[model samples]
Target: MPHYFDTAHRQEIETLRQRWTARTEWPTWLLLIGVYAGWFGLVLASDRLGLWWSTVLLIPLVVLWLSVQHELLHGHPTRWLRLNKMLGYAPFAVWYPYTLYRDSHLQHHRDEDLTIPGRDPESRYLTAERWRGSSLWVRGLHWLNKTVIGRFLLGAPLALAALANEERLKMTAGDRHAWRMWLTHGALTLLMLTFIARYSVLPVWHYLLLISVPALSIAMIRSYYEHRPRAAPEQRSVLNEAAWPWRWLFLNLNFHLVHHDLPGLAWYDLPHAYQARREQWLARSGGFLVQGYGQLWRRNGIKAIDSPRHPFH
Candidate 1:
């Protein structure tokens, strides 16, 4: 629970928090309204837009909805957890449940466990032993998952499969919590899909395949290199100076290290905090910085960024 920021930097963050107390979090509020309005508006207008065009437009809004969900889980735009959950609980993205994501992401914030297989729920790496023990086909899939195009195409399905397998095991072991969560998620997802089927021009399968899956893929871009195996925990996260488009879509999470350091800071405040002490943050992270996502794509287009095996393991 300790912050990575030094005393003075902590004081500066505290000052920002004080400023937040004096006024409303209008940006986060607007983001909540805007993402919902945009998504619903587009869905309602899909008949005129055609399937492909509507799918293309819907992808960004869905991605933004995921981002807004992230913000809500982080206690944004509201102080009450129940209110926040109510705002984000609709299964618009049509995959993971809000409660599941909330729990997993909070666990992922345990920085010291980051990038470690079995510990960090969001880790992309496997333990060295696990990698060594895998079948060739399994290893090949991991390799494909390392590339940009492959991650875009394979990331969502792979992640979903893994989550399903894990939850299956948990349910088999009589984990009632997991069962309850999935049942609730299933009911809500069915309701949302039903609404889309009745109201939208896009068919249910088309929306799932084109809009929902691709939205998850586009969202995965922010996380593609968000963390890496490193001896120092603070150095594991990357500071991606991504372009404005990505920043807006990911809710400024490209400043991943900053988010890890000050997890309580609002998404809108992240850029200012990082820019304020950019040098110190870079030093603290041991220079784990990417110029931008475009650079990431060009550099790791086909090649793996690094071994998928966790070096520390």
Candidate 2:
């Protein structure tokens, strides 16, 4: 793959990395502490807050936790992958195992394969063959998945079902690693649900349906059109100039091209890095940019942004 930064830019980024190393990532550490503290604090206070209020408050924390997990998997706040895994392994989001996500996401960083179905594990597109084979209703769901409202309504369930089916196939094929991860995820998820059942006013079912699921739905917003298939690898990922609230919720991943260019760059530094070479970055992306999520909703709310079938396939 071609390097995004030239020699000078790379050296400048190295200087920033050195500075970060010198001070340590205190901000990320604070984020780790604050997100966990807020989530637990809200859970504990759910009875006083009432179900609706608590669910509303808790969803953002859960979404932030997902962002934190993304940071952890990328070696944020610390260099130790094991320690990061230890911090992130809790089934707080209540669906994916940390290791499962880590492995798939790292594969997704292979820019050459971005948005290629079967090659990119995180791809939203379907293979042409699969698209052709699907029933009309199944095809309708894929079309819906391309729309903003459809993504919020069906994204989490569709993604969860696909992941679950993949893991089931792996387990059936005697994949012990898959088995272990799922078992561990099951135990951790059960523990979390048990705690909510015992201590929180929100019912466990309600927590799953209202809080965790919706959090996943919201997180999916960042990725709804984060990548597209382009002939050039660098042109594939998007540069979404999302609003501050969206940026904070996704932890600067709104700068998707920047993150793709510098997978090891800390979340806090992404915006500055992108701003430093804004034009060059934009050029590299072949001008694949959006003003904000609001633009996406206004233009593609009910309309499919692009065909669900992979263009290359």
Please give, for residues 73-188, the per-residue lDDT of candidate 1 as tens digits: 99888889999999999888988889999999999999889999998999999987899899999998888889887788888999989988988899999999998988998998
Off by over 4 Å in 2: 1-4, 20-23
- Model 1 residue 106 lDDT? 98
- Clash pairs for candidate 2: none
Question: Candidate 2: worst 10 consecutive residues by lDDT?
Answer: 14-23
Give each model a TM-score. Answer: 0.96, 0.97
Model 2 TM: 0.97
Give the local distance difference test score of model 1. 0.88
Score each candidate by Cα lDDT. 0.88, 0.91
Give the local distance difference test score of model 2. 0.91
- Candidate 1 Cα outliers beyond 4 Å, as residue runs: 1-7, 20-23
